[model samples]
Target: MHNTRSSRGIQDLVDLFDCFIVDQFGVLHDGMRPYPGAVDALVMLKRAGKTILVLSNSGRRSAPNEQRLLRLGFQIGSWDYFLSSGEVAWKRLDRLLRERGGAEPLKCLLLARGGDRSAVEGLPLEIVDSGADADIVLLSGSMGDRFDMDHYRRLLEPAAARNVTCICTNPDKIMLTEVGPRFGAGRIAEVYAEMGAPVMRIGKPFPEIYQIAVEMLGHPPAIRTACVGDSIEHDIAGGRRAGLPTVLVGTGILDTLSRAEKAELFRRHGAAPDYFLPAFTW
Candidate 1:
């Protein structure tokens, strides 16, 4: 990719793309609330005829965290559509049951935000509701982005011995949090794997959620549509796989990529986010 224009703010990048597919957790809200410029930037995008959707790992089995955003003062009611990792988890579970019959509803331990299951509210499954006596653990955001590695290890030891598989709801290892970058389910899932427990990850930058997000759009989005996010692994990789232009947010999980990391990504997947912004402005 050749140099187009260089900018650090969201407003500066708006003219670069017509549609914005933003990552929810890190790019907008951290945990306590929405960042200062998130709302205004998104509003600008909308007013400028940009169609935006929050693409999130939370969509695996449910809608994105609208209530969370509302609590952060983002007025999410106006931005009605979002794809979450929760929805992806639900679909993955659905496929597993169908492909492998007699696989009873998952005796699952959900590892996500408090309101993550909006899409899986009545779905048939024996969800253990994290910290419960679950046969398997569904991992993701830590109860609204508050998680500790020590706590996760304590929870997993016994389950590993019992032959429980940990289902990773979000594959991104770290995310931008109010306190700074912190671990995500992808990191926890890795620990589970090292312990010899089976693991499965659903949602982006995994492929499952991407397909669903595109479907929700009713048709393939226009070429001008942009997959905006912070991580090259989930957001950028998934967007490229879906054949969409990607917008890399400088303020998200992977903001401080090492030289080697950046080089590896380009050498392997050729990621060159069409636009880069420090925050979602414009």
Candidate 2:
């Protein structure tokens, strides 16, 4: 039973951990741009001799994310590494490729940003236009900003009927962007599951991505690692499930909620963070 308490900034809790698992979207940026002081926070952690991992649920692979962050004025080299759910998914896809040896590349139906194929750029996977030609369905993101579940149902139901296994790089149901909260790949995957297809989630709230981050931190004990993120269901709950200390940043998905409302939200979800802050900063 963890009681949610507020801290002035990330600096207040700096002494408690040697490694930081930082979420990108809410804590560092809001999709459209980086939050004020977020970049400085990274530099502060680096100066404090702490290992920082930008653990993000972004559907794009780390390379592209790094490039995007650099464009947004974040010092890319300040952190030890940037890890995204797409990279984790690519690993699994790579494994399947190794098992197939000399066979044809696995055909994949990709649902992602039109120009963003970084996740599968060098993989032994072939992007196909239709579900009928696909061996697996890869959902990197929503097709558009609408988040029309009914529209997705029409698209994914056919693939589900074909029993296509779907791998969702980002398991966030809603992306909290500056424009507004929009549907993510997770929601599309949900509809596929309802229509009877196996959905493999590769992001937060799941253990794989956290395991990778932990491994990169030289297998440190859980006590020395703290995960700071904005989403309770995805970040806090996921970190707690992975046995890492969790910190909830109120400036993201929970920005509009009051203290009491936040408490109720955590209770409703049956997950709580060790610490809470109004915003993530040094």
Candidate 3:
């Protein structure tokens, strides 16, 4: 059993934590805009000298995510650092290619929103039009707006047939879109995995991304750090794995869930947050 406490806002738990590893899409903003009082909550944290790190499962690089936040009215000094799964994966891929010492560039079948190639922009990779000719499948983003799951399945069937490995930077199963929630890249990666292709997920609920985020915060004590997000599978589980307390915010994914439904979800995911907030207010 988990001892989950209800928090009115960030203020209730301000003195309990020195650092905060916050999720972007759900906790801070939806896909299109910042949640009500989200920006002010961040500003309050900064004013209280709390270390704030916006950690996101976005498949886009850090710069693009940062630009989006800025456009959404997030000030530059609201957080101490920002890290994205795509940025981390890109750095690792770049390092591996450098160590290979002049090998042929790998052919990549890239999937992203609006044909965005920022995830692999500077990597030594050749973007192939067909999965049959690619060495690896890079599942960076989802185009659920234009393509449906059937289309994604058709696109990955050829690659799955060849047993090509897929690297999924964003492991979010559901994405909060302007219209509503949609299946995310992680769900697409699951489809490929179901078709017998190997999928390597690199994001929340995984250790590497959390380890990297903690390091970025100067290795603060785990007890003094808390992970805030709206998902149990990603945020709560990931925070537990990283040895930090977790806070569940109701501004995003948990907004529509009833109290009973939320409890069922906690049982289903086998993870519960240490604290729950009605919203991201300070």
Candidate 4:
């Protein structure tokens, strides 16, 4: 059903790719801390004359994200452009709300910490009580840390009953954090979906975000681009959807998938990436 090809390594895809769409979590660093050699891979790629376009689903604001990277001993450089799903959600919401010409502001039930709410700045959203439910559900990160699962499970019910539009700002299932691996927004979204609620994704695996990222390059299409990330479902799938070659970083899910499973996933969605690496290059 899909045109999939199995390549041996990164070198296989390097030839045709100029820009890279990199996932932040499992590929770059975890939520709590930065992973080893991740920055080096970025620097190496930049030095090689390829345009580096960082794409991430991190729900935290750019300020906090940079600070987190710095404190975690990762070299974030002086300035780098990262397009987060939060930013995407805000823009889409803003545009949609404006186009509707409805003075009634959009209500948001943020599924993340208040700190992460910085991404929603300037948006006309009423961040009300999670239990009360809102017109739309904006899931940035996870409420698992600050709130209880039972609470989340409870929150899902009212939102579903009201037929609130569910929007997952990030499509990440798990992140490698300083405190070890942890669940992401996609995990919560899945839980909501199980209750027969609607969920829309704004980040990876969706065409919208990457479409904007590529345009930021200011270069014509087919400029030799590559997508590198840890998750096959999101990052790899996004690259496939974008029609760019991709690199599967294995440090996160490699041990979990057998050779057959990985092969099948790669081939199931269009041609498999031109290359596969154990993790981000170093």
lDDT of 1 by residue, 1-282 (tens): 333234667666567666667888668766666666888877766777666678777634443366667767886544637777776676666676677666667676666655455534565567764444777776766532576788888877778777688777777777655677677678888888888889987777666676777677655445866787777777877888888887776665555776467657655766667666666665
User: For residues 78-150, could you state the per-residue lDDT of candidate 4 as single tens digits?
Assistant: 2246777777777777788778785777677887754566656777777876635488888888755555566
Candidate whose lDDT is highest: 3
Give the alpha carbon lDDT tens digit for every residue of 40-150 in model 3. 999999999999999999899999999999999998889989999999999988898899888899999999877778899888899998988989999999877667899
**lDDT-sorted candidate list, best first:** 3, 2, 4, 1
Of 1 and 2, which scores higher on lDDT? 2
Q: Over the stretch 26-74, how does candidate 2's per-residue lDDT look in tens digits?
A: 7888877888888898888899898988999978888888888898888
Kindly indicate the candidate among 2 and 3 with the higher TM-score: 3
Over 4 Å off in model 4, which ranges? 1-16, 61-64, 76-80, 99-102, 131-133, 145-149, 178-180, 267-271
State which candidate has the highest TM-score: 3
Alpha-carbon lDDT, every model: 0.69, 0.85, 0.91, 0.70
Pairs of residues clashing in candidate 2: none
TM-score of each: 0.79, 0.94, 0.98, 0.83
